[model samples]
Target: MTTTAPVTTPKEKTGAETALADSWRVVVLNDPVNLMSYVVLVFRKVFGFDEATARRHMLEVHERGRSVVWRGVREQAEAYAYTLHEWHLTAILERNETD
Candidate 1:
């Protein structure tokens, strides 16, 4: 039988390091153009959030005008932001911060 070597993660290598030392942010912004119901629906359809969670986020957008919806690796965050844009929502990617 063939054997494979175990894989090690970055966090495993650097025990004291923060995971987001190299992570990215995905921000979704509010828009007057989209209906509230549509925003909730899109959040649910795109991120698989339930109605309550999606509605909460949509409400946050309505009140605050923007929200950092997700955080992860840069490439993934950029991809997600782009996907949200394709869905006609405003989105952006930024480097995650420790502070």
Candidate 2:
């Protein structure tokens, strides 16, 4: 009779799994420089948000001082933040911090 230890293999994450694991948020901060209409326009242009949706997010930023405009993988979040910066809007990336 012989005894042997069982081997265990580590699971590898697929692309979708990795993306879900690395979720991020694109938050826009309220600023004194840009007008509300302009912010709405940028949101529409950058994200293809409809007028009502754009205004909703714009209002959130205006009233709350910040709004999370988008949530997705890190790369897309970074791209959105960069584009918002180019449009002169204050934007940042934050980890999702939830499952």
TM-score of each: 0.78, 0.81
TM-score of model 1 (CA atoms): 0.78
Query: What is candidate 1's lDDT per residue for 7-81, written digit by digit as tens?
Result: 986656463345657588888888889999998888888888999999998999899988777878787888888
lDDT of 2 at 36: 95
Clash total of candidate 1: 0
lDDT to native, each model? 0.84, 0.94
Q: State each model's C-alpha RMSD to the native.
A: 10.2, 2.4
Candidate 2 global TM-score: 0.81
- Can you give the lDDT of residue 5 in candidate 2? 94
Deviation in Å, model 2, residue 73 alpha carbon:
0.9
